[model samples]
Each structure stands twice: as structure tokens, then as C-alpha cells.
Target: MGEEMNKDVTIDTPYITLGQLLKEEAVVGTGGQAKWYLREHTVSVNSEPDDRRGRKLYDGDTVQVPEVGTFTIRSK
Candidate 1:
């Protein structure tokens, strides 16, 4: 990915779910689609592959979605 593909997502809560993050970033059309989306795509959390929709993402976590971009979670 290019420099433009790096994005920071801010959250107010302690953590955000993988599904919610995808929806917030417009990666998926709806929250329900996160499950299927994960199955079809490769998502790396902190350099490790993770496909759990309910995966809790906290501040400083890095998520990489091939073809989409890299997401860094930030606390607000």
C-alpha cells in the first residue's frame, strides 16, 4: 500500500470490534456483512492474521486489509 493508504481511526471507547471498525471505515456496507467480508478478505491485526468479527481493537492496534488500506486505531 501507498502512503495515502495509511489511515488513523479514532475511538472514544476502550476498544472497538473488528466488525464495527470495518463499518466505520466503510469497508463493509453493513455491520452484518463483516462476517462474510472477513471470510473473503485477509485482515491482519498487529501483523497477525485475524478473522474474528468480534475481535477487540484497542488504541495503537494496527489493522491491514489488502487492497483496502492500513488502519491504525487511535484513542480520542
Candidate 2:
């Protein structure tokens, strides 16, 4: 399969949860799916393995899933 395109995600809040970011980016269809994906797959936050669904992502944070795409969080 071809790799998904990398993307930049803008957030208005002080921070966004990892699950929320996945859902908002349409990487996962629902919040539950996001959590399930987190549990089943490896996700990297700033090059470190991060599985916490509630992990807070602030501006400049980069999240990557091998099957999906890299997402860089930016302030809006």
C-alpha cells in the first residue's frame, strides 16, 4: 500500500488528546477506534512510543502511525 500523506493539524485548545487528534484527522473513524488502534498498534510521539489515549499533544508535537501518516500539531 502507498503511504498516507503527512499532515499538519491545527488546534485551538491549549492541547489535544492523542485520541482526539486521530479522530479529528480522520485517521480513525471514531473515538473508540482511535483507542483500539492505540492499543493494537505502535504510535510514536516525538519519536517515542506513546499508547495513552488521553496523552496531551500540544503545539509542535509530532505524532506518527506507520499505517496512517505523520501529524504535526500547530497552534491556531
The most accurate candidate by lDDT is: 1
Stretches of model 2 off by over 4 angstroms after superposition: none
Task: Specify the highest-TM-score model's number.
Answer: 1
For residues 1-76, what per-residue lDDT tens digits would candidate 1 score against the true structure?
Answer: 5443889999999999999999999999887899999999989999999999999999999999888889999999
Alpha carbon lDDT at 47, candidate 1: 97
TM-score for all predictions?
A: 0.92, 0.92
lDDT of 1: 0.94
Per-residue lDDT of candidate 2, residues 25-70 (tens digit): 8878898998899999999999999999899999999998887889
Error of 1 at 32 (Å): 1.4
> Root-mean-square deviation of each candidate, in angstroms?
1.9, 1.0
- Clash list (residue pairs), candidate 1: none
Residue runs of model 1 more than 4 Å from their true location after superposition: 1-4
Error of 2 at 48 (Å): 0.4
